[model samples]
Target chain A: MEAFVTLDAVAVPLPLPNIDTDQIIPARYLSRPREVNHADFLFHDARRVPATDEQNPEFPLNREAWREAKIIVAGKNFACGSSREAAVWALFDAGFRCAIAPSFGDIFRNNGTKNGLLPVVLPAEVVEDILAQLEASPGAHIHVDLPKQEVTAPDGSTHGFEIDPFAKHCMLNGLDDFGVTAAYEDDIAAFERRYGRENRI
Target chain B: MSEPSGPRTLFEKIWSRHRVTEREDGQTLLYVGRHLLHDGGATAFDVLRQRGLKPRAPDRIFATPDHYVSTAGRKLAEIEDPRHREMVEKLARNTAEHGIRMFGLGDPNQGIVHVMGPETGLSQPGLLIVCGDSHTSTHGAVGALAFGIGSTEVAHVLATQTLWQRKPKTMRITVDGTLGPQVTGKDVILAIIARIGAAGATGHVIEYAGSAIRGLSMEGRLTLCNMSIEAGGRAGMVAPDETTYAYLHGRPYAPQGAEWDQAVMHWRELPSDAGAVFDTEVSLDGSAIQPMVTWGNSPEDALPIDAAVPDPESAADAERRAQMRRMLDYMGLVPGTPLTDIAIDRVFIGSCTNSRIEDLRAAAAVADGRKVAEGVLAWVVPGSEPVKRQAEAEGLHEVFRRAGFEWREPGCSMCLGTNGDIARPGQRVASTSNRNFMGRQGPGARTHLLSPAMAAAAAVTGRFADVRRLVGG
Candidate 1:
């Protein structure tokens, strides 16, 4: 995992609400290992024409101006369907450092934190404003600062957001969650021994 | 663990029972009672091997190969694709290396993880369960606090047998009165999702209550809880009752002798206390819910069978109208067409949601003595080996075959189209799976979600027919 402090990059807007994980990375590609670069699988179906296997020019990611976007502005309940972590890996592997939505699927938000990608939740109106600004300026850059918990729009407007403190700490430092939980192994083993006697499973 | 002072909901009782410690940052470490795994979880094992970590509690873990296994037969050779075959073999090798119990192919207990968990009595009341797949909530029907986790969390549970968590708020959905005939638990859940949008239960664990919910059999409750993720719920659970006990009484892994009595006593106290409060309350009239079928890409796009495809012009706002138009275009549906008039190219009656014997019986009853319509293909894939055996003994397979429906082996076939059991592109399907997302069946495949009986009706009629009409509600 890479440490996150601040990033300034071009952002693209995907205005569809309830965009699910199946749309992010279809289930067919799920069997592949994490070592595989998942950027090719991200939106594999939606990025092509269904009838002819041709590149879909209408999709935002396919547009010339948004091809290098590092941030995604989406509608409510983004990534709302499955708990597949591959969805986050696809986005992160695609060079997206941040995702801004009015709300998000709980599991997706958790998955995002573990990876290097930052999931930023803002008010619906604020997200709409940022999306509109990005759409008006296709190559506009939106600035995200993790320590300040703020997002700066292209139009020079700033908005504040909230994240769990522990999550924030992990994001600020590129800490492996396994190491952190392993530190409490003693306490966990003690609890298990006592619980085993009481539950008698 | 110290008992908290105050009345508690079912979720609270389980959460406190599993709590090991809490940090000031609101992250609590909860002990996992059971860790279920499937073929898709092979990467998690690779992560563990890479880190040189052993499973903290191998005895508490169980696994089965479902996601990528072929439904044509119970052999590795049956899985033609090398990528899919490697995944199934890896699960067996990984479980063997770790000394964890895996119901691999050819085992009588082999099946989808969710169905195999409850059927084998590995899932019980007041337990904390986690799985890598999102449909792990299906175990919550037994009164356990089960939810899906990501790959990293899967690795976390395997290494430490503990996970960090923030407690979710509780929502109680009460469906009062008795459900009318032909209105199955699948319909009730679909109705619930339609009432509350797809993300209505996000960040909340839902507790299903009231007469109608309690009346459902254990299998029905599993079906209802299975789709909690479709509504964006962290988990869904029902209070254990006589039905839950009966279902687990003599299963392979269930408690026996004195332990059985003790377990029942504990489960008896697992329901919410009288007058216990919830963060949210939602009520529905059970008798009013009709058989449902989804017309759009999202599970929340469901509508009663009698309703027509909605017109974009009637949408409440501009954004909604645009979304509706896209859905209509993708589904190849015309506005104002009666849902019953929508034709389907294929019918799939399986998946974790509706593959139990009860679901098979429902579909078999409808398909009795009726031939499938011309040009429409239908398949009945059982959920597990046990379900397949039971269905065979009851002659349900013969009924389906006699009705011109293909009877197949057990696995997740055509649900997500990962096992080479996908519909052709542009094929419209009436499916009994939980999700109806775009391309969920296959690329450019349009899926309509419905109950098993409704799917059978569609198979016979060559269109989306109302189940109530055939079953005589």
Candidate 2:
């Protein structure tokens, strides 16, 4: 779980807005064992026809540019509905290191931060600029340097994204909920010893 | 950092008693007393298997299968989606493999997990409960500490009988006075959310107390807790009483004669001491609550059953005004349109939230002498096979069928668009289920959350209407 927090590539061209958990990974995949390869389940249904057995030929991911794209630029309200952590597991496992959106679902945002996924909130027009760059030059990448607190898309364009200070502090240090608690484990022990079992429900 | 607080709400009482200790960060390591299981638990089971672990407290675990499968007609084995069918079969097989107690498919004790917990007494006061489903908090009605967890956290509980959590602040909601006849527990919860606004209880656990809540049946209390998330609280709970004790007297998991005596003594001690404390206190009058309806994408976007859609211009808050305008446009509801004037294409009276035998009986009471509107596609699904069988024996199913409502299999059908039973886009559906979020039913579909009785009456009238009209007529 060690994290570099160093800037990697970024895809400025955002994906469609209001991306739902089901669209990230269909509900059918929810029944599978969590250890199963959930990454493959992402966009499984959207790639295929709703009523028919055929796959959509022009879906974005089907395009060559997105074959190995690790950074996803998405529209507003991404990761909305159902606090399924598998949604985060899928995006993280799929090699997506960062997601830039105007707005994000509360649960998904919290889960993303806890799981080491950096979520960058930027204005819509700023995101559209990156999309234009990606569209103009396929396979374009943006640098999202966590330590530097900056993002540089492939076209050498610079953008400043907002990250909650508390969350940023945790991700760069690879601290999970327990890891954070361990910092105060000594204080917790001292309190318990002093209070005896009165506090133990 | 403690709130300007005094006199613990039931939530504070449980939190202080359960608190192992607060760590340096905003995290708490409290002991979990019980963990309920359900059909949608296969993912957690898989995680446990991968880690070579089993449930640490076998006695504390409970399970049922009412999702991704069904029990009305020949639905036990007939599954349209192979994915859903396999999930149910796997859940049943794995529960057996784990040697954990299970109310599996066809078991009379089996039903919606939340519905059966209170009925059978598994959900008791002063206990901590967790499950793989978000609605698990519905068990908090017995003054228990209950909340949902991710599969990973579920695995942590299975392996160690505990979970790593950041304790939320406590909010005390005092609901006094008696409710109006039409203001059921569902209405009470809706009304609370409407007043508090959607995110009012963010980062908090709610303690519900008052004569109004105490008077609700175990089934109704579960309904109240089930929708706590709609208010952004981690969970909601009610203290135990004679009704709680009576509900748990003789059930499969409840303690045996001597053990039961000891357990009840402890459960009795679960209430807040005369002088405890809470972080925040909010009081409301239940008598003022009315049958309510959600008119927007979020649950908070609601009004009393008799009220008209609000005009955005009348909103004092800018964000609320924008949201109101958006809701009006999306729902195709004019600002001044009366809620009763809205037409509905479908009526669904079943889900984990509602659809218990009691819920069914309530709906049937409204459906007794009426027939479903010809244009309405109405369906009644019991929470479990046992509920369906019981309702059939009591002729509740017949009552619905006679009224032209289709009595279908038990899986989580329209509650989520999971099992292939979804309303078409643009159709308005009155659902006795949770979550009326956009596209929650199906793409472009509109959903109105209501009680089973309300759903039944709506089915007959082909619009959102009051159930008391049919019930009292």
Candidate 3:
């Protein structure tokens, strides 16, 4: 995991709400290993016109100005379905380091923390304003400072957002849960032995 | 988090018992009792292999290949896509290498992970269960603290038999009155989502209570809990009682003899104590719930069977109006049209939600003497091999076959359509699965979620109809 302390980059505006994991990366590409670059599969279905192989010109990512965006300013409840971490992988592989939304699916939000893609939750009106600003200036940059837990809008307004302290610490240090949890192996093993012996479960 | 000295809710009791340690950052390390795996876990296993880490406790894990397995046959070669076949094969290889128990293809226990966990008694009361699939919440029907995790968390649990987490707040959704005819758990859950939007339960663990909830069968409870994620709930559970005990009594993985007596005693104390408070409380009149059908992209877009498609012009705000317009366009539904009048091209009566023997019996009863309406393609895929065998023994398959619904092998067929069981683009489907998201079935496919009986009703009528009218009291 790459530590995410701060970033300033081009942001894309996706104003649609409830953009689920199935849209982020379809189940068809789920069989591929993590080593496979998932950039091509990001929004695999939604980036195209429904029932056609052609790329939909109206999609934000397809527009020339936002083609190299490293941030996403989206609507409420973005990535609201499924527990697929592959969705986060696709976004990260496509070079998106952060997402700002009114809300997010719990599993998708948690997956973002583990995979180094920061999911920032802001007030709905604030997010709406950000989306508007990004849409106004298509190739504009937004500043995200993790150490301060603040997001500077394209118009230069700074807003604070809350995140789980542990998740924030891990994100800042580039620490994955596996290694940190593995460090407590002895304690876990002792508990398992006692738990199994006493409960017989 | 400090240990409370007073009465605790069911969720708090389970959470405290599973707690191994707490970090200064407030993330508690929880000891996982059972970890369920499906074919989607192939990548998680790959991560473990890359790290050269072995499963700390392989005995705590159970694997089954469902997401990518072909529902048309039992053989691995039957999976049309080589990539999909490799996923299922890798599950077998990974489980074998780790010494984890896998109900591989052709095994009697093989089926959707959610369905298999409860049927085999692997999901038990007071246990903290986790699975890579969102529907794992279905096991919480047995009073377990079961929830879903992502691929990275899957690898973490595989390497260490625990997960670090901040505890979710507790909610009690009490449905008090007796349910009306054809008002099954599917209807109850849909009604809940309609009343409380899709994100209503975000960051909360829901405990279902009240007389109406207690009255439901185990299968109905499973159906309700299976869609917890659809409502944005971390997990949903019903307290264990005689119904739960009866269901687990003689199952393969359940405790036996003296241990069974001991386990039951402990389970009896697992329910929330009197005067124990929840962070949030929601109550509903179960009798008011009618059979529901989703008319748009989200599960919250559901309406009663007799309702009309919502007009976007009636929306409260501009944003709401635009969202409704887009959903209506995608679903190809006209405002003012009765839900019963909407025609469907396909009918699916299976998934982790509503694919147990009880669900098949309900569908079969609806299909008993009625022929499937022409131009409708209906399929009845059982949840697991045991469910299939049970349905066959009861002759439910013949009833479905006679009614023109295809009787297929067990897997998650047509649910997410990962196994080539998708409907054609632009086709409308009456389905019994949990989600009704955009392109959930297939690109450009519209899904109307309903109960198994309701799905059968649509299949026989060629359009959405009230199952209450078809299945007379």
In order of lDDT, best first, we have: 1, 3, 2
Candidate 3 on B398-438: residue-level lDDT in tens?
A: 99999999999999988898887898889999999998888
Model 1: per-residue Cα lDDT over A1-201, one tens digit each:
888999999999998889999999999999989999999999999889988888899899999899899999999899988889999999999999899999898899999999988999999889988989999989899999999999999999999999988889999998868978878888998999998876654
Candidate 2 ranges with C-alpha deviation above 4 Å: A1-29, A32-81, A93-110, A118-201, B1-8, B16-22, B71-76, B311-330
Model 1 lDDT, residue B315, Cα: 88
Task: Give residue B367's error in model 2 in angstroms.
Answer: 0.4
Q: lDDT score, residue A168, model 2?
A: 74
Which pairs clash in model 3?
A: none
Error of 1 at B397 (Å): 0.2
What DockQ, on C-alphas, does every prediction get? 0.79, 0.19, 0.74
TM-score, candidate number 2: 0.80
The native-contact fractions of the candidates, in order shown, are 0.71, 0.16, 0.64
lDDT of 1 by residue, B129-223 (tens): 99998898899999999999999889989999999998889999999999988889999999999999888999899999999999999988999
Question: Each model's TM-score?
Answer: 0.99, 0.80, 0.99
| CAPRI band for model 1 | medium
